[model samples]
Target: MEFKFSPLAYVPFVSVENMIKLVNSIGAETFMSELAVAIEEDFKRWELFDKTPRVASHSDVGVIELMPTSDGEMYGFKYVNGHPKNTKEGLQTVTAFGLLADVDSGYPKLLTEMTLLTALRTAAMSALVGRHLAPKGSKTMAMIGNGAQSEFQCLAFKAVCGIENVRLYDIDPAATAKCAANLKSAGVNVVSCKTAEEAMEGAEIITTCTADKQYATILTDNMVGDGVHINAIGGDCPGKTEVAEAVLRRSDIFVEYPPQTRIEGDIQQLPDDYPVTDLWQVMRGEAEGRTHDRQITFFDSVGFAVEDFSALKYVRAKIEGTEFFEHLDMLADPSDPRDLFGMLS
Candidate 1:
């Protein structure tokens, strides 16, 4: 039996190779800047989206998570995993894929590789928040834990927040060298430092992005100064944290969702009832961002699902007239309604 599939059965799919091509074609800095705008648009209307913490299954080795969200009109989700040991085995510490669907028909509209997209979106969101909370006239950023995410963080800050100098430091000298080399032509001053404190010197914005599965203090209390905005992104799961308890207590912490941040972010080190500001409220003008130049501001980012939804939405729009994706026949469309089994035969 020859079966004809309807156009609805085909969904646009962006593979990993194609995703790389798309980023290169559009330019990484421009892509992240535009993506930040999309994420900000969603953040302003944060009340309209369905929100929850990502569902995660954890093990001694790593964790696998599903992040899902919807804006009443469109639904999206990303399947991702984190394994710190993967790097020792010559594999990525994190990888992901995501899908966007139409709410009316519940049919998938787009599917794309999200590993690269996640890095882009995470950096973009960090820089977006920096633009709001960092001290006025901020130019230098301290990039701690130079790894897969370091260069992207530097470039995103340069593109979105107008950061001009990025001081890089990591436990591994090779990693710092790799990051500096990659950012050589990225239009920012790349400074390699020996110690974390050295990196933070003269830096107004400090971004910590280490990959460890345990409670580790990457920043101590005395190390942090007033009038600095801390973008803490490395500690994103239970038992994995980067900042010290004293530092969190002193800073005015802002989070994406309290329920989630209390469990997964650097704020996890604080008491459950500890007060924190919501980033959405700030975006919506309901809460204050940076009140005093001498005050410390902290952004405890846990990578919310709505941000991923926004990134997927941005990719869907950008790839409309471009050859950055292919049609994937992923649904069953029987010529006769309700005859799915017959079409299979």
Candidate 2:
């Protein structure tokens, strides 16, 4: 696993093609499971990390954000954009890249495309929370959004929580068909449903991930039953949400970070002081998860910086001694450290 170059001077880059090959080589299920373990480990040590809400710049059609965190030794940040309307033009709704840097040197150690990594980490985070919060012996999940992220969520749950079946529903029938086709040989049963209610049938975990700009209710109060874990991810920016307000009132909510969730998660629809359990605390055993079989546990996921940092760490470890990553000449090497013109000369 030794590097060919001095690690400080060369940043490893994982492109989309390389990332695809990496996932295929490790098998998607195994990669998702390992990534989930990485995320859980980071969450357990959350107190050591500097946490903050994502900084966002919004526009009429989309929003771009910078999510950054540090653990005293290393710093990581992701540059991501979300455009819900992009799908109409045959483009991805989310695109991202990220960097991991040495805290003291302030020099990047790795630069990688995060669009694929984000999907992997997000699914890992969701399924990891499901392992801790979902009904015991849960085997089925209802996925309400059948877009780009649907397949990853399905496989991650199957790998980590033993979910054997997924009922898929989307407003666009073609999306559901595409998702079902993609999951045909994924080793989990894929059911294409006509409505959200149909998708929820016999599902112990309900995941809502619709892409919309405004507060849209993908799941209503009546549709959500007791004893189910709700994974809400699409409501990542202000004014965007997927679950009903009443649903939030009935569930014991869990969040990555309360400060950010209040602005971007489904809890944004609730009062400022509404109760929430930080998921990291649950991982650290400072708080309880799924105290009762009938209790509704909700993971108001907004995709945190720490999760991205963990994913970056996992990718770096997995790509070492492999050709999945390329070294980029991102930093200038100067024999005279203080001479500005020495490197060029």
Candidate 3:
């Protein structure tokens, strides 16, 4: 055998800024649609994924959660907190961080602040589902809960669905004002409405990404119109919901992963027997999506870990040799594989 040596390979440590830049370079539409395909690819072989329901720790103040998902090949996890009251204290409502690691080596490849990426991916996921459920010639969208995730959702719809008009409403007028001011330069017809009903008028797609952690009905059956696609995002955890039970019952519901969603999605309010469609089947062409223009369709988005997997993969592919990066030393090395603790010293 010929004598050979290997050099230590450095891992790319992407920051929130770099990750956003990477996503921008790929074009938001490309990143989102590609993410939809990646999520579908992973869901097709759901049995291969090490799917653990999110681990949540709740306190009187707020909630902290850890969502982890892996395919026995690549591992990813996100640490995010939902503190709806944070904004009252002049802080962000959701703060998050995540990591991507190689399952074989248990070595972390990238560590990133997911506060921004969460907004990006959540918006992307919403638009992807809208791609299937929304009616053709849909040009307007109504956005409820115009908070930190509001701008991203606005941009996502335009980039993904070609939506040109965004109607916005929030319980807090300041938040709605913030959203309007931030997105003013995007060249869309932005409307700040007084009520949810006012926002949903003439809209093809309705999105709810509120910060409330209670079962507050942001949208009711009366507010909805025929053929409107609803993207419910805020009702993500126990005791957290944005849609009325009547609305869910009247509409055809689609979910990412049914088991976790049964506990976290709007379906949580429904009886166990209440029917809902798993979106993976739709992606695979096994189940029907938006069967009729008059049928109401709802995507119960609770934020899936698979989106992080897809986001990381997309970032890696686009930023192959970019200069806005870092090399991190986060893994340990041991002379003997069995003596894991020996490398700590």
Candidate 4:
């Protein structure tokens, strides 16, 4: 007898190709803006979610991590890896996949390629924070370390925070050129600079995202002037940092989760007892974001799991009335709950 598969047996899978189509269909900037709203909503309810530092396994070459979180009803997790040397071998420096499952049933619901989703969610997160923390009426932004993430960051700020000009700089001229070219039609002025200092000229928001798995200072204290919002997203793991210690001392640091940021973010360079504001609290209006005009607001971003959970939830909702995903028969559901062995007959 040929048995039929139950609807519960299939899981919705969003492939890389479909994800690209979905982004194009919704427009990248709009997608990220919507994602930012979803993330901020989650942040408002931050206390209800299960939070922990991402579980990381480090090797000499790179690191692999599992970021997991749940809001008591829906559970989500992302498996990601960061290998800076992968670019030398013509591979992505960061790649990821994520899953969402029902908390009560413990069955997988949505599975999607988070590599693209991660980039969108990360840029959205940065811009969302910028909307709150960056200096008021900020227009120009200096983007250091132009790479796969640079274009998305530029667009997110433009769409969400009203940034008009983006000055780009990278160690590699080719990378700068690539970023500039990608942003040509993005409705923002892109300036390719030769040096990091040149890029920071007249910029209010500075974003640093260099991919080096070591302690490196992408921004010194002197480079960061008063009233600038620093989005430091590069230093994501232990021993990998991007800002100078002096810079950290001068800035009012904000982070997603303190326990994780202390271990992995640029704040890792500071002492254990150093004070940093929680981003969730700021979103919930319990804490201040930018107190004064000259007060430097440094966002030590290490890519938190809750943001990924928000991204997964956003994708799950968007794919409901669309064809951007496929149903994968990932579970074996027997017609009779106790007749699992008889399904094959």
Please give the RMSD to the true structure for each candidate, in Å.
1.6, 2.3, 4.0, 1.6
Q: How do the residues 1-345 of candidate 4 rate in per-residue lDDT, one tens digit apiece?
A: 232698887899999999999999999999999999999999999999999667889898988999999999999999999898999999999999999999999999999999999999999999999999999899999999999999999999999999999999999999999999999999999999999999999999999999888999999878889999999989888999999999999999999999999999999889998999999999999999999999999999998999999999999999999999998988899878899899779
Candidate 2: tens digits of C-alpha lDDT, residues 1-345? 444334567888999999999999999999999999999999999999999778889898998999999999989999999888888899888999999998999988889999999999999999999999999899899999998899999999999999999999999999999999999999898899999999999999999989888989999999999899999988888899999999999999999999999988989999999999999999989999989988999999999999999988888889998999888877775655697586665
**After aligning candidate 2 to the native by TM-score, how far in Å is the CA of 345 from where it should be?**
3.3
- Write down the TM-score for model 3: 0.90
Which parts of model 3 have CA positions greater than 4 angstroms off?
1-11, 23-30, 334-345
lDDT (10s digit) by residue, model 1, range 1-345: 232588888899999999999999999999999999999999999989999668899897998999999999999999999999999999999999999999999999999999999999999999999988999889999999999899989999999999999999999999999999999988899999999999999999999999988999999999999889999999998899999999998899999889999998988888899999999899888999999988899999999998999999999999999999998888888888788789767
Instruction: Give per-model TM-scores.
Output: 0.98, 0.96, 0.90, 0.98
Where is model 1 more than 4 Å wrong at Cα?
1-4
Q: What global local distance difference test value does model 3 have?
A: 0.82
Q: How close is candidate 2 to the true structure, as a TM-score?
A: 0.96
* Model 2 misplacement above 4 A: 1-8
